[model samples]
Target: MNTDIILTCAVTGAGDTPPKNPNVPVTPRAIADDCVAAARAGASIAHVHVRDPETGAHRHDTAYFAEIVDRVRDSDTDIVLNFTAGGGGDLIPELIGTADDDRQIRAAAGSDLQTPSERHAPIGELLPEICTLDCGSLNFGNAVYLNTADWLREHAALVRDAGVKPELECFDLGHVWFARQLIDEGLIAGDPLFQLCLGIPWGAEADPATLLAMRDKLPVNAHWAAFAIGRMQMPMVAQAMIAGGHCRVGLEDNLYLSRGVKADNAELVAKAVDIIQALGGDVATPAATRETLGLRGAP
Candidate 1:
């Protein structure tokens, strides 16, 4: 079992989950505050996704990202900020009838798609120490999360040129395969960092066997972490540490400290720290994590 662990807290996701929990951190200031709290609670990194303040909908506006980044940087607390560069790819399809009785498929009300450069805008401008590069597409709930191979190659090149580390987020085995291909193509620099995302609808399942299978498929020189959503979140943390990898936990992946107990980002991070200590492992600080992953440090 690996002893030293790099823990990440995904402060807020791009989902419509604010209504379900009041502590979801919608505004830029709230999200930045949560990131600082998570760092104090022992999180090495904070994975951030901004939402529209009024509507609580996910947005790709660089202004929102800038506000959050500024707040975090202005604070005295130190933590690695990982911005989400995986937005604007939601594709919810709908069929409509034409005047001539023909049918056509088009994006539905919830569909939000953008060109690669549009998606890369925030990362390119802000240039955080790390940003997410979702490896592949999958059936995400009722809609499809689309990320084609060509788009991925272009996105990878952009991240590499910016001198930022891309956290390869693999939702399935095929994603792991494609991530390896990106590494082989030399688009990914230094040691590759992977985040094995599990238990999200039609993606990889949350279980020890599934995690092990995906872990085995990773390149030997890769640095990786794993997380599972909902109730399996804490269980997977222990499993990841035991399997010789890092762990991630936050309101983005889970909202409850326990059954029927609501949790904020820092609480989830504290719980994960307790789990790491219980398993006889220590949590890695942001400085240590930067060294371990070869990050470019704070920007």
Candidate 2:
């Protein structure tokens, strides 16, 4: 277990969650507020995603990102920002028609698709401390999450140019393997940072053995963290620390603090802090996290 762990609170993600909870923070201002609150509540970093205030859908516009970054930087709380470059890859085939041959090739009406450069535009313009780079494509439930090898290379080049660190988001074992390849290709800068996403349907399972297996595959100098979704969110907090990794918690990954009780980003971050301390581990501060992760300053 890591004695000095970094707690990152993913304040708002591009998930279909605004309808389920009123406190999900749809607007840029609200998201920035929650991100500050999460930092105050003991999170070293805030993984952010922008949403359309009106429809609560994910938006890849630089303006939304610019506003969120401005608000966070303007706040008193000092938290490392980790914006997402993992958008514009959702592919839903159902709307394209259920024909057998058409399912794999056509995109539905609501599909948010973009070139790698387009996806990397916000990261370039805003240049937060860090941004996410999903390593590979996988079956993200019924819809497919597409991050092909070529696209990932282009995205990595953009990230390297921006001088922003990349927190590799690896969902399955294959994704983990490909991340290592990215490092070998010298596409990633500094020591690699990984977010081992567990328990997503058709991806890696959120079990002790699975976490162990994935962690063992990480490069020697790489820094890594692990998280589980839904009911296992809190449990994985202790589990991840016990297995020698950092922790992530927020409304994006899990909605409920209990069976029927809903939680906001700050509450989830506080609970994660309590869990980390209870396990005899100390949560790293933002300054310490920056040094550890080799993060660059805000642009």
Highest TM-score against the true fold, candidate: 1
For each candidate, give its TM-score against the true structure: 0.97, 0.96
Expressed as tens digits, the lDDT of each residue in 190-297 for candidate 1 is 999999999999999999999999999999999999999999999999999999999999988888999999999999999999999999999998989888988885
Cα error, residue 109 of model 2, in Å, equals 1.8
Candidate 2 is scored at a TM of 0.96
RMSD of each: 1.6, 2.2
Instruction: Encode model 2's per-residue lDDT on 45-73: one tens digit a residue.
Output: 99999999999999998999899888988
Positional deviation of residue 50's Cα in model 2 after best superposition, in angstroms: 0.4
Where is the poorest 10-residue window by lDDT in model 2?
95-104
Residue runs of model 2 more than 4 Å from their true location after superposition: 94-104
Q: What's the C-alpha lDDT at position 30 in model 2?
A: 100
